[model samples]
Target: MFNLFVDSLIILLVVVDPVAVAPLFAALTHGESAATKRRIAIRGTSIAAGILVVFALAGGTLLDALGIGMPAFQIAGGALLFLLAVDMVFARHSGLRSTTEREQREAETKKDISVFPLAIPLIAGPGALTSVLLMVGEQGDDPFVIGTVLAVILLVLLVTLVSLLASARIMAFMGETGANVVSRVLGVVLAALAVQFVLNGWQEGFMLIEENASQMLTV
Candidate 1:
């Protein structure tokens, strides 16, 4: 149980990448007032959680029905995740610029910015989705472990929202320079986690192949 929980915890943390997202959140919510920021933070976390939890519960089963193997999924997911990582490193303007512009125009009219750029792509983006499927695949039949890990993910989301609530104080102390430093560090961590995902998939795939070869030889 302990081991399962620990593995789940790692999966949750790596997938969620709360630390990496913090600076981005800070920047996005920069001009919003305290109450608005709080609401946005809470709602954003909720939305992200809902997306991941739904996928976690059904992703593996869906994959099996499709006759897809984990090795194939891993390679595909790794490529998607790596593309996202590249984007994170480069910090490009979202391709939905026209839509974002329209939203921004709407925001100026009504001061609403919670759901548009904040919640969707930034929070519950490709990185999170890949993480969900990969972790679900890794969990296999360990429902106890999966549940525990999910609990930890919820806790982490709560803590991250709390940190976001304290964004004012953190920004006041750290300023943009400090925040950028923190963001870069978190990116490094995310990169390492991404590498680990690839490694684990490769390791398991090779081990399965080895076992199959041994069995055939013995037969």
Candidate 2:
């Protein structure tokens, strides 16, 4: 259903939080010219798209091969989400660690902050990765749903690109306080989402165990 796509897209956006990454983008490209920043945004997002798409396409298969169930995944995802949310609430980096020493060097040397911090950890961090896994697990092999999710990702990428292009204006508008507020609010939402993920995992585990027991009784 179209609704399925919508649902998945919403979850992905919350998980990705490209808007949150905009500030980081600004920080990374602070001294660069407008032209360079634009290029970085494009390159960074394009690279991120490749990475996520690979995950989106292969996550389901990888889990199935490993015999991991959705419930287990949900719990793991929830835990990660919870941790990230807590980080966000505290004005922490949400464990992104982009503003670090080693990464800073890489950012400076590569002259492509977009691909390094902006795209990799910021846009497609651990929380995003876990969310993708859960989403892929939920969607199963539904082609339409998969397509919808991809479309949404592409759309988000576009938004990120545009935001980067307009980075200066964006910074002036949201400023530091406004951006931090959004981060904290999203963090709250993420924490709740994490709790739900853990619950879902537990429920699935119980159901699977019950099914196994019933089969034993029949035998």
Candidate 3:
């Protein structure tokens, strides 16, 4: 359980990449009043939290309804996460996880962006949503593990909110190079975790096939 909590926390934090998104947040909220910026940060984070929580709680059921098995979800989720990790390690913007240049330009022109780029794509993006589903599904209906994963999700969201609130200060302190260095380190860890997910999924899939074959032979 402790391991699950730690692993979930690490995966959530890395995928969320609060520090990397700080610059974007800062840019988006540039020249806004302190009160307005506060509203944006709070609103964005709250909406993002709601979205992630929904997916974490109901995502597995939704997938099951679609006849998607855990092994397949794990394999695909692992691959997607690995791609995002590669983007993080290279300090590049991945359309899978990050907003594109077009989005950024459009955001700059918008008066309100709490829900568009900030809450959806930037915070609760594909990688983050897929991660929550994978982690929750990996728990396999264990209440303790599920609770721990959910807690980690909330914790990461809290941290992300704080990072957004302190974007300017954090950017000033870490700078671009320092931020990239931290992201790369987390990216490496994420890549390893992604590979483990894929391996577990593959092994389980093969075992399932073998078991089916044996059952057929016995019958």
Candidate 4:
């Protein structure tokens, strides 16, 4: 359980990447009043938290409804995360974890970006959503484990909110270079975790196949 909590925390932190998001948040809310920035941060983080919690709870069911097995999902999710990790390490922007150039342009025009780029793609992007689903699936139906994962999600979001609220300070402290360095370090960790997920998925898939083969032989 301790390991689960730590692993979930690390995975969510890497995927959500509050530190990396701070600069973007600062840029987006540039020149805004302190009060306005505070409001946007609160709203964006709240919406993101709500989305992540819902997905953590129902994502497995949604996958099952689509006839998607956990192993397959794990493999796919890991692959997706690996791509995201690569993007992080290179400090490049991709739709997996950040908004597209087009999306950014759209965001520039929008007055309220809490739901569009901030909540949906920035805070609760594809990588974060996939990570939540993977963690929840790994926990199976264990309510305690699931609860722990959910708690971690909330904790990460709270941290993200704090970062957003203090985006200017964070940007001043870390700057672009420091932020990229941190992201590269976290990216390496995420890459390792992603590989482990893929390996576990392959192992489980092989075990299932062997079990089916044995059943067929017996029949």
Candidate 5:
């Protein structure tokens, strides 16, 4: 359980990628007052947390309603994350985890970006959303484990909020070169985790089929 919590924390951190996000946050909030930037950071992280919590709580139920299995979601989510990992390793922005070209252009023209690209796509993008749901579903119906998962979610979001709050200083200190180096390292980690997810999904899927077959034979 402790190991699970730690793994969950690491995976969430990699997917959230606060270091990668700082420069973008700094750029978007450029020219704003310190107070306003702080507000945006607060609101963006808050909204992102809310969105993730909803998905974590209801994602499995929603998938079941749609006749989707955990294995299928795991494979699809892992594939999407792997694509994001490639972009991260190369220091590129894939729309899977970041903004699209159109979103970026639109963001530039918006005054309040807290709820737009910042909260929706930047902070709580597909990578982050998929990660939370996967973690929650993997834990099944254990209340303690679910609570731990929620705690880790909050922990990651708190880190992200702090990163956003310190974006200016973080970007100035790290610069693009330094940031890319960190991103590439995390990218390798993310890629490995993504592959693990896919494999877990495959194994679980096979086991599920085997169990069904045995049950049918008994009946």
Candidate 6:
């Protein structure tokens, strides 16, 4: 349980990446007043938290409805996360974890960006959603494990909210280069985790195949 908590925390933290998002938040709310920035930060983080929680709770059901198995989802999720990790390592923006250039342009024109780029793509992006689903699915029907995962998710989101609220200060302190350096380090960690997820998926898949083969032989 302790290991699960730690692992989930690390994976979610890397995927959510509050530190990296701070700079982007700062940029997006550049000319906004303090009150407006505070409001945006709270609303954006709340929406993001809600989205992620819903995914964590219902993702496995959704996958089952699609007739998708855990091993396949795990492998695919890991691959997606690996791509996100590469983007993080290079400090580049991609649709997996960040807004596209066009999306940013659109965001600039919008007076309220809490829902568009901030909540949907920035805070609750593909990578983060995938990570949540993967973690929750891996826990199976263990209530304790699932609870731990949920707790970790909330904790990470809380950190993200605080980061967004303090975006200006964090940006001033870390700057782009400093933030990128932190991201690169975390990216390497995420890459290793992603590979482990893929390997675990392959192992589980092989075991399922072997079991099916044994059943067939018996029949």
Residue-by-residue lDDT tens digits, candidate 5, 14-39: 98899988999888878999999999
> If both were scored by TM-score, which would come out higher, candidate 2 or candidate 3?
3
- Candidate 3 per-residue lDDT over residues 1-219, each given as its tens digit: 788888889899999989987888999999998888889989998999999888988888899899998999999999999998898899888876777788889998987889989998999999999999988875657878668877998899899989999999999999999999999998999999999999989998999899999999999
lDDT of residue 172 for candidate 4: 92
The clash count for each model shown is 0, 0, 0, 0, 0, 0
Top candidate on lDDT is 4
**Taking the tens digit of each residue's C-alpha lDDT, what string does model 2 give over 75-145?**
87788788788887887765642457786667767665666687778777777677767766666588876
Q: Which clashing pairs does model 2 show?
A: none
Q: Candidate 1 overall Cα lDDT vs. reference?
A: 0.65
CA RMSD for every model? 4.1, 1.8, 1.1, 0.9, 1.2, 0.9
Candidate 2 structure, TM-score to reference: 0.91
Residue 169 alpha-carbon offset, candidate 5, angstroms: 0.8
Off by over 4 Å in 2: 96-99
TM of each candidate vs. truth: 0.74, 0.91, 0.96, 0.97, 0.96, 0.97
**What ranges in model 3 sit over 4 Å off?**
138-140
Where's the lowest-lDDT run of ten residues in candidate 2? 92-101
On TM-score, who's better, 4 or 5? 4
Candidate 6 Cα outliers beyond 4 Å, as residue runs: none
Whole-model Cα lDDT of every candidate shown, in order: 0.65, 0.77, 0.89, 0.90, 0.89, 0.90
Q: Rank the candidates by lDDT, best first.
A: 4, 6, 3, 5, 2, 1
**How close to the true structure is residue 48 of candidate 5, measured as C-alpha lDDT?**
91
